[model samples]
Target: MHEVKAKGILSAQNGMNIYKGCTHGCIYCDARSTCYQMDHAFEDIAVKVNAPELLEQALRRKRKKCMIGTGAMSDPYLHLEKELCLTRRCLEIIDEYGYGLAIQTKSDMLLRDLDIMKRINQKTKCVVQMTLTTFDERLCQILEPHVCTTSRRIEVLNILREEGIPTIVWMTPILPFINDTEENIRSILSACRKAEVYGIMTFGIGLTLRDGNRQYFYQKLDQHFSGMKERYIKTYGNAYQLPVPRGKELMKLVRQECSDAGIEWRTEKIFEYMHQFEDKEVGRQLTLFD
Candidate 1:
């Protein structure tokens, strides 16, 4: 990991990524796509040494409280986070400023900050978002080689549920011909229901492939699933979105399952929930003192 001084920390929408590049090694990472223009090796991990300080400044200047988001372009709980604690420091600042948190990751290390998350939720809101691509443990290892598997993430979700911290599941990038089966989708959705997740965000049954990520994904396919690359080339042939043949059917099932469980499926609504900030202390005062 290398340290760099960032000019700014939070986005106009209040999203932040404490680090650039990732070591989680997901085979189909869109962050590695050429459009993002990452300058260093994807695993080098550029650490924003000033992230906590910059976040504190940003939170102090804001006139109104809102949810602060992170882990969009890179997982904030990556292995480097264990030592650097940049994410932890930023969380402390958000808690200090009374802002909500909406953090996304595919790692189990989030348990390390469970106390901070509970503190934030008690004051305002804290939504933990976990991405589950496949339910089969062996397949999960092949797809997201370096991070925690789906079962462990489910455990994290259940723990969050018990802690009164809301959670969301991102069931995305369902690779065509690899993980786009009805059974796989059903299994993941079933697990989400068991975990009592507040919402499920899905973009149909397919994955996107671009100039940079497409090449790397194909290479891994050749390594793990022989002849899969040729099949993809023949089926997709330079297309960006690789929708599965059964995408429509699979998505219909997804909608029905979410409806049955009362878990949200609308992407916009879920995002609105994450961005909206509510102060429980203020609500309590209004209810009792109004």
Candidate 2:
């Protein structure tokens, strides 16, 4: 882990990454793709020591409150977060400024900030987004090693639901000849149903592989799934998008299951919901005055 003073915190779209790179060791991580251009190793974890300060400044400058997003490129609750507390501090600032939060992570460590997130949710919106790729516990361990498994993530979702904090699941990067199966999709959707997630975001029924990430993914495949790398090379042949053969069928299943359960399956609608900010305290204040 390394610390660096960042020039700015929030993006033009209000998204911020408290840390750059990750330690989750997920075999299919796209953040490692060459297109991103990280100066150091992916696991080096560049910590933005000034993130909370910068975020506070940005929030104060906003004429109108809006949702502040994080964890798009790197998990804010990475292992270093436990001690650094940068993510926690940023969350407190967002809560203080009455801005909504849309945070994405696969770590159970997020539960540590439940109090702050609940406060933000009570005042405005706070949505927790988790990614669930493989349903089978063993496979999940192999695919997303070093992070919390799917079952634990599902439990976190259930806890969030009970707390009245909305949640979304990113059921993405379904690896071909690996986790791209109907059973995997159905099982994950079933868990989502039980957790009562607000939405499930999927980019079809397969994962993307580009230059940097593709090489890393293939290396892991050779180590874990013997001969899988050769198969991928033969099947994909340097393609960026590697959609599974049963993508259409599996996607149809996702749409049907999400529709039947009243969960949002449309990617655009889910993004819209996460970006839109709501102030529940305002409604309560009006009601009290009335």
Candidate 3:
């Protein structure tokens, strides 16, 4: 890991990535695509040494309070977080400023900051988003090798629910011919329902393959599923969005299940929920003015 001084922290849309690159060896990572143009190895992990300072300055300058998002390109609860505490410091800043937080992660290490997240939610809003790809524990290990398994993530969701903290599940990158089955989808949705997740973000029943990520995913396919790479090449040569044969059927099933469980599955609605900032004091003041 190397530290770099960042000129700025938050995005125009109020998102922040405290680190560049990732150590989680997920084979289907889209961030590996050459389109992103990273100069260093993906695992090298470029740390923004001044992220907390920058975030504090940005939040203080904001005229209106809004939700702050992080962990879009890299997980904030990486192993290094235990020692560095950059993510924790940033969370403190968000809490101090009384701004909402919408953080995402695949690791259970987020439990370390449970107190801070709970306090943030109690003051405003704090939504935790977790990505669940494969329901099968063994398959999950093979796919997301470096991160926590599916069951453990479910536990985290349950913990958040008990604390009255809303959670969202990102059910995506369904690898065709590997995990694009009805049972796998059903199992994941069942877990989400049991945990009382606010929503599930799913594009469809397949993953994307581009120049950089495609080659790496194919390599992993050869290593794990022997000859699966050839099948992918024969089926989807040079295609970017790879929709599985059962995509339509699987999508229909997901919609039906989410509807039955009362979980939000619409992409637009979920994005709107995460981006919209809700302030009770501001709402009361506006009501008085009107």
Candidate 4:
């Protein structure tokens, strides 16, 4: 890991990535795509040393409170976070400023900051988003080798549920011919249902393959699932969007299941929910006086 002073932290849309690159070795990571243009290796994490300071300044300058999002380009709870605690410090600032939070991660390390997140939720809104690509533990380990598996993430979701903190599940990048089966989708949705997640975001039952990420994904496929690379090449040559053969059927299943469970399945609605900021403290203050 290397530290670099960032000029700014928050994005125009109120999102921030305290770190660049990632340690979670998810084979289908779109962040590795050359389109993103990272100068360093994907594993060599670039830490924004001044992230907390920048964030605090940004929040203070904001004329109105809004939801602050992170973990889009890279997971904030990477292994480096265990020692650096930069993400934790940022969370403290967001909570202190009474701003809402929408953080996404694949690691259970986020549980360490449960206190700060709970406080943020109490004061405003705090939504935790977790990406669950594969339901099978073995497949999960193979796909996301460096991070915690799906089952552990479900446990984290349950913990957040008990804390009255809303959670969202990102079921994405579903690799075709590998983990695009109905059984896999059903199992993951079942877990989300049990966790009482606020929503599940999935584009469809497939993953994207581009120049940088495609080569890396093919390499992993060759290493683990022999003949898989050839199959992919034969099926989707030079195609960016490689939807699963049964994408329509699986997507229909997802919609039906999510609707039955009262979980938000529409992408637009979920994005709106995460972007919208709610101030519970206002109601609490009114209640106290009454």
Give the Å shift of residue 104 in candidate 1. 0.3
Question: Model 4, 6: alpha-carbon shift in Å?
Answer: 0.8
How far in Å is the alpha carbon of 167 misplaced in model 3? 0.6
Sequence-dependent TM-score of model 3: 0.96
Q: Write the per-residue lDDT of candidate 3 for residues 63-175, one digit (tens) a residue.
A: 87788899998899887898999999999999999888899999999999999998888777889999999999999999999999999999999999999999999998899
Model 2: lDDT of residue 140: 92
Given candidate 1, what's the lDDT at residue 254? 89
Note each model's CA RMSD in angstroms. 3.2, 3.5, 2.6, 3.6
Between candidates 2 and 3, the lDDT winner: 2
lDDT of 2 by residue, 71-150 (tens): 99999999999999999999999988888899999999999999999999988889999999989999999999999999
The positional error of residue 88 in candidate 2, measured at the CA in angstroms, is 0.3
Q: What TM-score would you give candidate 2 relative to the actual structure?
A: 0.97
Q: After superposition, how far is residue 50 of candidate 4 from its true place, in Å?
A: 0.6
Q: What Cα-based lDDT does every candidate model obtain?
A: 0.91, 0.91, 0.90, 0.92
TM-score against native, each model: 0.97, 0.97, 0.96, 0.97
lDDT of 1 by residue, 1-290 (tens): 89999999999888999999999999999999999998999999999999999999999998878889999999999999999999999999999889889999999999999999999999999999999999899999999999999999999999998999999999998998899888999999999998899999987678999989988999999999999999999999999988999999998998999999999999989988888888898783211111
Model 3 ranges with Cα > 4 A deviation:
281-290
User: How many Å off is the CA of 281 in candidate 4?
Assistant: 2.4
Please state the error at residue 257 of candidate 3 in Å: 0.8
- lDDT digits (tens) for residues 252-284 of candidate 4: 999999999999999989988888888785763
